[model samples]
Target: MTTPLLTLDTVACTRGGVVLLENVSLNLLPGEARIVQGPNGSGKTTLLRTIAGLQPPSAGKLQAEDGAIAYAAHADGLKGTLTVAENLAFWASLFGTEDIETAMSAYSLLDLRNRHAGALSAGQKRRVGLARLLVTACPVWVLDEPTVSLDAASVELFADAIRQHLGRGGAALIATHIDLGLKAQVLDVAAFRPAHRSDGAFDEAFL
Candidate 1:
């Protein structure tokens, strides 16, 4: 059997003394794509953040094979001062990868290479952010609302990129309200809510 890329065992989170998730568990395997869906305030973003290790879960465990993951959040996280190409090059360098020109072309950002990211439109900034993912060699991607601000054509482009990644044996955990036209296993976070909070801890009944 193939090794799973990610595993979450009884994961839970609390912020400002409120429970976000309670005993959430899931696993991701190679070449599999999972979509996380929930209404606002359902702890979708909190779950992604916890999985990315940006925020520690208040309970349970998250396990990964190693350093084969890339995470893209809702905020573009681009440096406004840098030109599109400059930002891509910087990330590529950190990943020890080359082919910046090709990566930009794939994301349809070749024409905007010389433009400062801050000066770009919202959709353009989002494209630049997506371009950074292509430069990384990581095998697993955790994307939060990747389709935000993208036009229909650009959305299709992004979907094609994701398909290619999965076709190459990469796995993804995407959190988005908008559909990206790719088949994905779905995880609904609302099912894991706790019945009550007692002594600042989530009730274990939901687990």
Candidate 2:
């Protein structure tokens, strides 16, 4: 049997001391993609954040290899003054990788390689940000609304990159509303939301 790259056993996700999701469990294996689906405030982002180690889970068991996950959130995580190539180079070096050629080519960033990230449009910046995933050399990807500022073409580019990553035995957990045209498994957060708030404290966090 193939070992799972990530596993969450009855995990609970919380934000600002409020439990948004409880008893959520899932597993990601090699060459698999799982899409998280939920309405606004369904704890999708919180779930991803917990899984990416950005925040601790409120409860339950979570397991994954250390330094095995590459996360891309709503923020582009770019240096305004650095050129696209320089940004990628910085990440590549940080992750012990030296190749940025394929990553740039995959996102059609060869043309914007010389431009500073701050000068690029929202979509352009998003493309460059997503491309960073390629250089991290991690086997697990955890993304939150990766297509936020991407256009149709750029979305296709990102989807193709993911497909290629899966082809190479990588796994992904994505949270997005639009379809990326991949045969990905889906998880709805509604199932994990508590049926009733026992404390009666108003839940205001954006889940």
Candidate 3:
């Protein structure tokens, strides 16, 4: 069997006396993608955040073979005053690379290169955010609702980028409500939801 880029074994998401999910386990292998789907209150975003190292798992083991994660969540992670190309260039530079053209081309952002991030529409901003993943060159991606605010064509573009990323032996853990043509394996966070919370912190927000 191929080595897994990321591993989560019997992970539980608990906090402040609440149990959101339990007994969650998965192996993210190279070139593989996993779709995390659930209802509004389900812990989809929680799971992705846990895998991304943004949040610590309340229980169980988490490991990564590649030890890198490129994560994008609800926030677009863009500077409003900066242009599309500027944002990408900044991230690329931070990642120790200087080639921003490839990422812009992948997301069809060439036309918006001069456009300020805040001035662009939601879909345009989403494209820019998605493009940052490619610029990072990280082998694993953890995305939460990456398709939010994207139009049909833009979604298709994002899907193609994701396909190409996986084609390069990258792995992804995505939590999304809309389909992005990824052909990913399914992981429904609702399946691991606890019947009740012990600490009276029953509320959990969705991404």
Best by TM-score: 2
Residues 23-56, model 3: lDDT tens digits: 9989899999999889986777777777788778
Relative to the true structure, candidate 2 reaches a TM of: 0.95
Per-residue accuracy of model 2 over 72-157 as CA lDDT, tens digit each: 99998999999999999999999999999999999999999999999999999999999999999999999999999898999999
> Which pairs of residues have clashing backbones in candidate 3?
none
lDDT of each: 0.86, 0.93, 0.86
How many clashing residue pairs are found in candidate 2?
Answer: 0
Off by over 4 Å in 2: 198-207
Residue ranges of candidate 1 with Cα displaced over 4 Å: 198-207
Q: Supply every candidate's count of residue pairs whose N, Cα or C atoms clash at under 3 angstroms.
A: 0, 0, 0
Error of 3 at 75 (Å): 0.6
Which candidate number would show the highest lDDT if scored against the true structure? 2
lDDT of 1 by residue, 1-207 (tens): 988889999999765567878999988888899999989988888888888888778789989966677889989889999999999999999988987886798789988999999899999899888888889878889999999999999999899889998998898999988878788988998887777755344444334
Off by over 4 Å in 3: 200-207
